[model samples]
Target: MGSEGIMKDVTKQGKATVLALGKAFPHQLVMQEYLVDGYFRDTNCDNPELKAKLARLCKTTTVKTRYVVMSEDILKKYPELAVEGTSTIKQRLEICNEAVTQMAIEASRACIKKWGGSLSGITHLVYVSSSEARLPGGDLYLAKGLGLSPETQRIMLYFAGCSGGVAGLRVAKDIAENNPGSRVLLATSETTIIGFKPPSLDRPYDLVGVALFGDGAGAIMIGSNPILETERPLFELHTAVQEFLPNTEKKIDGRLTEEGISFRLARELPQIIEDNVEGFCDKLMGVVGFQNKEYNKLFWAVHPGGPAILNHIEKRLDLLPDKLDASRRALMDYGNASSNTIVYVLEYMIEERLKNIKNDQEDHEWGLILAFGPGITFEGILARNLCA
Candidate 1:
């Protein structure tokens, strides 16, 4: 199996820059055990049976818990939004939109400050998420709040699901590559709280979901050749590939139900990885002019969909258990934050990888980043580490 590069490997080093990156999460960390306990109390389900099932579901090679922005407490605090009759689904959606929008703006502002860039310099804004939905949504509101140029290109991408963080990177890379001297801000905030239903026969998993998911947001600043000159670089974009497997449609899906947005994850999701990931990696690596073995340092910033998915990938790729520690840690700490989860993993990677840097000149390390989503699609990037 020959490894190759899929897209144009932007080899001519145009100044490398990730001007800034910021992440935000709810204050409280929700434990899966606590969720199972709640489910047992709320639904009168068998505690022993439910606990055993939850233990299996919570088994991740790396993560154990996740942050929840709107717990039962947050909802209770915002009684106006969750009101009896007046607070329609539309109203509840508005509340979530407002909360996540503010989060994205704050994170973006922090990134700009850290990287020393002006909001005026930002020419494009990209927002990605699957957990929450709204119209004239977070990205547009964020641009306005920051007083960015009205002419700035605004992109609101949806339904990419968990893979959205890295997928947003790919989208921004294309925009930057085509527009000279352009700066873009990418923001992702995932909140599954609105989708948290009390219980229903249609969604037996809601109990697990209410326990597992948490709200989180991540922002990154990317710029073309000029800004890279002043910015501290983390990794340079080499090539990115988005691959969709044929006939594996039901692995993960987000659909609209009467209650709110519902998530359907097939029991066979692990098996889907078993059958497809190796070939997917083979094809992705082929696009980057490198074989798997030759790339000494690999950064697998995978979306922590759950414990089982991560474990399956680790086994399939024959990666060391520790290889996905950042991802597992993020999940244990934040749960599956849907689209924004990968950014947390990437943040941990950047923090750890940058610590050992000896110089700013030797930027030759190679890395791989992967994110999976509802389309049963995988978005991968082969990048060169620029931390030195």
Candidate 2:
């Protein structure tokens, strides 16, 4: 086949379309009010001023409540849970691994059911997380727990941080597009409770993650099959791009220390996004023959890294006031689940749009899903919703 002929064949096979999505959160609740007024206050008892400062910062995150794998009772008993380097931290990860894996299984089941109920049909599994930072990967556990075929191709992505969900989708798209008739199950989960380190006044940056991070898992079904096969709303993948900004390595850093994984969140993250987000968006829009045009006309599913991240992206992109409500709302409701967070935002977008179908005109609505991670990496997908 000539180049044009091959291109024609590829278009005929169609890109991967998101068939369904399911999300799960743990039962243990950690309300922001408790973290600010009680947990942190008690942990940082020696410094009332620092406690007060943390309380005020916690509220600014806009995360009201988050479900963690750790129980409040357990946390209370092990005050050192806030601080790592203990044998207790190792035991905590063992517990976290189980909980996070179960969450992934539950979410995957939901996605499978919504995608026509065929667990055996899943040919590939793309699991994303950064919670445990362990081995034997979550993908194998997920496959075994879900009773998938023995030959199922599995890929577990670790340490991708906040961009893991989009990373899963990008990989699933490639797998599905290359292997026609294959169904790709993408699962994203995290146990951020393990990342919560021992409280420290000296490393104020560590608290940025504690204040915003939470735990959750999300599953999305992507396949190369025709969109008409299922009634679920479809996000037909069009284009995706990943870019790492130059000289920005230190801006968003996460490192493991004696006190668990510590995050060094730059105060200027919002400014960085403001300065560079447009160029990234321009690259995506440019793919669909639009460059430097009106951005308000587009639908957005941005990763609300925190309240500041969302606000900065909105202002920088010159988007509508509510353009990032799903992202903001996810943060408010679920905190930042890291790699799993963006999928929750996408799930919210799917639920809201599916519930309020106004007209046939909206059968196809263009959207951009964006995520930010370490290395100052930007992940984006240009997609179109195929209404049920």
Candidate 3:
């Protein structure tokens, strides 16, 4: 079928709209100013240079605090997790599977409550994670934990990195729009436990992970043709697109081994994304017949991969300073919870819009949600703010 034909058919019934959003974080909150001391002490690392480098990263990342699944109790229980060159994948998976599942259940329940719908009404589940590896995956565990219907259709996306949230939303949009009455609960959970390790010059990216990534889960309820009596539509999903830059696979790479997962990010990742984001976004907007729309006139929900990525995007698009307030606020409050970060950004946007509505202020109707992940993949979604 042709692209225009598919777009028409998809919107014939109605576009998928976000009904609600909720997020949850683990109990241990680490203050960035104190993270270096605790991290080094917990890992038994005495190298002053490595500690200094991490301290610098902590300040530069602009992350004030972050919640993590790892704690003194967990580190004490599984000392192997903090040891260098130790084969602790089994132990890591055990901790992460339980952590992610519980967080997912908590976030999902919050989302369902905000959605003002019975749990039984949800017909599908889309679970995304990059922190756990096990048989049956986190989806089955989440389904059981939430007491969802045994017949609920389930799809699990693993190792999607930072783009997993938007990727899952794209998947849920397809299911909701095509299946008529189907409502999808999209959940994303992540924990650094899977890749936690002692700071070493041999693996500089581990330090970056420590300074940036955090553990959390985010959930959103999605469905089309909302019943006005019960459902409140926040953002209408208009068009979604995914693309990858050529030969940039190595720029953002993660590998699973006996020691759990290890990630390596190139220094040029921010520059690479800045170079291509404009073209990618232009293409997505064109799909919805807004080819020449001004960028600043729309709301933005770009993933806060880090301070650098957000800065690069803001500059490249010539966006006003306030244009990325929600994104920056999410990063400051929660750090980058990988796939869960975008959910927090959207929630912040919604909350701000609600406040603005109360004060009789206006907001942009059209917005773009963007995220980058492994494979140098770019995910973009054009959405209309129904709440505005």
Candidate 4:
């Protein structure tokens, strides 16, 4: 086929669309109000000052509750986890590897069931996580647990941080669009277990992480052409783009140490993202043939990295108070589950739309999904609501 003919053939296959979304969380739930006492008790910390600081942070994060892999049983079983200077990397990895794999399997099963397709129909799997470090990785385990074909093409994205979910979806979109008849399952799972540490005066970021991060898994089914009889397209992904801000490499940093992974977030991180987001989003909107469009005309599914990041984006874009409701609600209910948080926000959007539909409310046809992570990366997707 000539270039034009090939282009026509590809176009006929259609853009990648989101057929379904599913999310799973660890069994242990912690309320923010009570977490301060338990955390201090678990770590055997006697510093009243640090406990007060964390209490304030929890309140400000707007996270009412969070799920975590860390529980009393596990902590009791592995007491070294809460100690200050223990080389517990092996133990942490063991716990997280199993936890993330199981969560991914549950989330994927929910997504496939919602997609109403046979497990054998999944042609590709894109698994994303930052909480587990192993040679074979969780993708292999997830595929086996889900009973996907041995030949299922698989790619694993590790340590993408908060943007992993959107990054995975972008990659899945390419696979589905390029390969006709492809059904891609994108699963993102994360836990704070690997990074959990005793609060220290030296590592203030650890407290911030304790206040902001949570554990969860999210899965999405993506395909270019859907079987109308058995599949329904929720969001049609039109364009996806990623950009790394210059001179901001040190804004967000994570290191793997003998103890476990450690993270540092610059106080100016939110400001840096706010400064660059408008231009980055404009680029994404331009690809969809919108120039200087009204921001409120479209819905938003932004990663709620923290209350400040969401507030910054809202203020920068001049968006309405409710423009980021889904993001805020997800943060309040689940905290920031790293890459998995975006999936929660998208799921919230889907549920809200369903409620709206029953009430005869209208929804916008176009929307955006945005996430930020290490590398100071910005991931954005221009999407259309087929269910509208």
Candidate 5:
């Protein structure tokens, strides 16, 4: 379809909104230098001088530290558990489930309370996660704990990796659209701490996995007016588009390893995104009936997958140098919170953008929410700016 045809199809409607959002972050900060040096020490590279060089590469004052569930002292207490080979399957599952449950509940409750909603209003619980997994997964636990409808439909989209948030939102939208009166509560909780394998230093890209990542959770409530209403809704869902590159599955893959789950970051990822982003975005805009230049006031709720991925997106999209400041700050403050990174970006916008919005009628604002992950896929959403 032509540009006008695309814009006509994807323009905003007046319903289906983000009623509320909430997030939880751990207290600890894993400094990049410390993490890099830890990896260098573990690798025992023949070139001693390379440690400083690698440290400088990973170091970023913009992302000074990352949060973790386990403290240094706590990790010291269970040295055997830190290694990949020492822990039994049951032990690993139990520990990870416990940590994820706690973080999920903390963030979920904060979100529900902030939005002034309750379990009674929720008809569905959807969770998106990649770091760890279990049956009856995190969403089931949330429904039970919150005393939500036992009949509440549970949808768990696991293993989508960093891009899970965008995909999850799409799933939630589908659910809400199908079940008109139902409100869907979406939560993304990741504990990379549980997947820590101290011996991954043999592979250079594996080093990137170990040095980056933190524990956190974020929750958002989405629904039609039939489900609920909010005095200050974040935004109405306009349209969403998702695309996957053919034969490029290896570009980004996360899977279970003996040490836990690990992510493979192929060096070719930057080039892959650079080559496809323009066309991918063009088609996405077609879905929403707009052009790239028309949607220039973008509040990039980008998944801070890694420094390299973010840099690649910046150059390919021709974004300003400081365009990803919020995402970069989140990486520095929280490391990569997986699906929660975009939530943190939304949080940042709430803090900064909400303040300046004129609380008046007839002022509909717009922005794009974008994220990418495994399948070498990309997802984009056109949203009516609630904060603006």
Candidate 6:
């Protein structure tokens, strides 16, 4: 960690910048109305109460559609996946191993293509996923699939939930900053479709997870320096903070069962974000050399966990009306893909910047990407336009 003269403990290593970003989703599309009305009804396995409750819960997320590795039609066609306690952990793991790896490879290909270079130049790989394939390390599969050099440094980060997305980026930032001429490939894939409407689980959390979480993969490249040949807008890392709040461990829980991992999400999560977000923002802004008057200049690329969480963060941070637009819109379009969500938000930001630049409008300079997970893990990245 070098020093920009901000805070001594916060590492200041080589400057890291985002060269490109790309996302991929399964071919199957599940609409909210169908999932809430038809799919849940079919999978609830005669539980009318669960179906009604799920419909109400899905509405709250404000998510219209989500991509899934297995479609509702496929779920209905396959008894093992649709029925309760039918598929063994081994079977489910096999399914996700292929689905998640393929998704990751697809997204990684997009990122590499955007970077416009050979994978031989990639120095390191950062892989993030909630899906725990039966195999020990899926990083080798990704590297092999992408034709990366066998000597590419591999750092594996799997099963961190939604927060893992930001966590992977943190690893990439460190690797890029600490090593010159470094190229870190950050990728995340989630196969949440396996957990969709599992009847062995209890109420509320299971239904909420079923209704809200979606399936997809996303990837991006982080470099020690920007790709000078490309005109891609640069996102430079300025601050990275990870805070584990006390006494909030039970707020969000993910446990393993015979069927799959069940999610136990408490209703107090939005309140938790509201309660502690200001302090998080304070730390980030101070480290980034932001003054009170400069707050408006900051854009937020937030994890669209749900509409409620986004709303709470917006209100707590006192951000502009449209500050959280990208998060909300991404959720609306793609649902919450857990660790894959932050990339969706970042993709949105990049797309917006590209649009503005093409239209000759002003591009945003400062931004913060935030993700919350099981530990009440509050992850934030203070970033700015690299050219600025």
Q: Give each prediction's root-mean-square deviation over alpha carbons.
A: 6.4, 4.5, 4.4, 3.7, 6.7, 5.0
> Candidate 6 clashing pairs?
2-12
* Model 1 quality (TM-score): 0.84
Candidate 1 ranges beyond 4 A from true positions: 1-17, 38-63, 72-74, 77-88, 200-202, 226-229, 292-297, 355-364
Candidate 5 residue 273 Cα shift, in angstroms, is 1.3
The lDDT values for all models are 0.69, 0.79, 0.90, 0.90, 0.70, 0.79
lDDT of 6 by residue, 73-101 (tens): 55555657666656456666777888888
lDDT of 1 at 177: 72
lDDT-wise, the better of 1 and 6 is 6
Measured with C-alpha atoms, the lDDT of residue 270 in candidate 1 is: 73
Top candidate when judged by lDDT against the true structure = 3
Residue-level lDDT tens digits of model 1 in 269-330: 87787577777767666776767544334666677777778888888778766677778878
Name every residue pair that clashes in candidate 3: none
As a TM-score, model 3 comes out at: 0.95
TM per candidate comes to: 0.84, 0.91, 0.95, 0.96, 0.85, 0.90
| lDDT value, candidate 6, whole model | 0.79
- Candidates sorted on TM-score, descending: 4, 3, 2, 6, 5, 1
Error of 6 at 58 (Å): 2.2
What is the lDDT, from 0 to 100, of the residue 272 in candidate 4? 92
Task: After the best TM-score superposition of candidate 4, give how far the Cα of residue 248 lies from its true spot, in angstroms.
Answer: 1.3
Q: Which stretches of candidate 2 lie over 4 Å from their true place?
A: 1-11, 41-46, 76-89, 230-233, 359-364
Q: 2 or 3, which is superior by lDDT?
A: 3
Candidate 2: TM-score?
0.91
